[model samples]
Target: MNRRLFTAAGLALFATASLAAPALADSLDQIKASKTIRIAVDLGSPPFGMNDASMQPTGSDVESAKLLAADLGYKLDLVQVTSPNRVPFLLTGKTDLVMASFSISEERKKVIDFSEPYGVIQIIIAAPKSVTIKDLNDIVGKRVATTRGSTNDKEVTTQAPQADMVRYDDDATLITALISGQVNILASSPQTMAAINARRPQDPLEVKVVVKTNPYAIGIRKGDDALRAVVDEWVKTNLRNGKLNAIYTKYNGVGLPAEMLK
Candidate 1:
């Protein structure tokens, strides 16, 4: 090939490669400069995130995000999001972090980074006592409902592949479905079952099987090393000082696991 032609081709290839490469996220620097950090929290997910009687945002995850912002001396901008859109909001730069009961998983790790676990959530198959669920096989033909794109949904979908999966966009809707008998079984957290029972005491759901105990962490975008480190340190500090536990216990009605506090 002619030298001019070869040079032109190489330059074109380099430009394409550069354009395709993802820009590194500088959330930490941006947050510091702006003195504000936008965090995504799911208000539809009760106990973790929800609205109070006064229509104010109140929940474990909400308090956690607020505390983090307070500690960092930054203004808190709580971005409301649903389960399926949490990661998308973070990835798209709509939010600086996600404190939305986000569980750490191998699949999610491929797309985003996480801070050290601040709390844990149990994924469970809950049904009314009349429904027999002696083992995984018992779930084969049942209608199982869960919040779409959540860790609970992923675990149940993978474990009980034969079951008819009914996915809802958020926990509030999932809880309503269970209460209204739209589905006989659900893959969700114990907190969700509590929320269901709160509304319908006549027919309370019972835990049939515990799917998995998942550790939840704050979600940070990939390549945001500075933000991750800061968030991790904040988590460790809060976990040690009892602030995180207090916030979690206040809303969750249970203390954080002893091991997580350590």
Candidate 2:
């Protein structure tokens, strides 16, 4: 090819590449300039993020976001997100950060940055007192219920492959199946089991075994280090001041876990 033609082609390619690249904006600066910060939360997840009787979002994650916005002197704009959509929402700039009980994991870290963990969750196997389930072996041959496509479902399927798995559309349905005697065991989170216990105080479910301990943190888009640093500092300060614990207690009826405080 002629030198002139080669040069023109190179310039065209460079322009196309630049146009395809996402415009990187300083998240903190944008929030400050706009006087607002958008946060994604799963309003369907209770104690962590859920709507109150008045249909207003009010939960541990929601309250934490509110505190963060207050500290930054910006208005909080909440966007409802589900487990599958949380990361996409943040990446697409629909939200500045995600505080919807997002559990930090190596796989997710590759796509997004996480602030220091501010909360912890225990995935457990819960069953009625009548059912004696000491471990995964005991779960064998038992009818286990879990939310379809959830972390609990994946764990149960892996750990107790011998067990009869009954998947429900959602957590509420899975819990119901267990409580109503349709299923003998349930794989669920501690907070979710606590809700079930509250509803059926007389029945009294017990935890058979803990499957995993997950640390929850705020999720930011990758390369947004400035915003991530600010969030991390804010979380550290709140953890030390007990403000984070207070927010957790307000929703879960208990203070933050001692391990999480560290």
Q: Estimate each model's TM-score.
A: 0.69, 0.82
The C-alpha RMSD in Å for every predicted model, in order, reads 8.4, 8.2
| Candidate 1: tens digits of C-alpha lDDT, residues 50-138 | 99999999999999999999999999999999876676677667899999988787766766789999998988888888888977789
| Per-residue C-alpha lDDT of model 2 across residues 52-136, encoded as one tens digit per residue | 8999989899999999999988999999998866766676678899999898876667557899999887778988898888888
Clashes of 2: 0
Clashing residue pairs, backbone N/CA/C < 3 A, model 2: none
Q: Native-vs-model 1 lDDT? A: 0.83
User: Which candidate leads in TM-score?
Assistant: 2
Candidate lDDT (C-alpha), each: 0.83, 0.80
Give the lowest summed-lDDT range of ten residues in model 2. 1-10
The prediction achieving the highest lDDT against the true structure is 1
Error of 1 at 16 (Å): 22
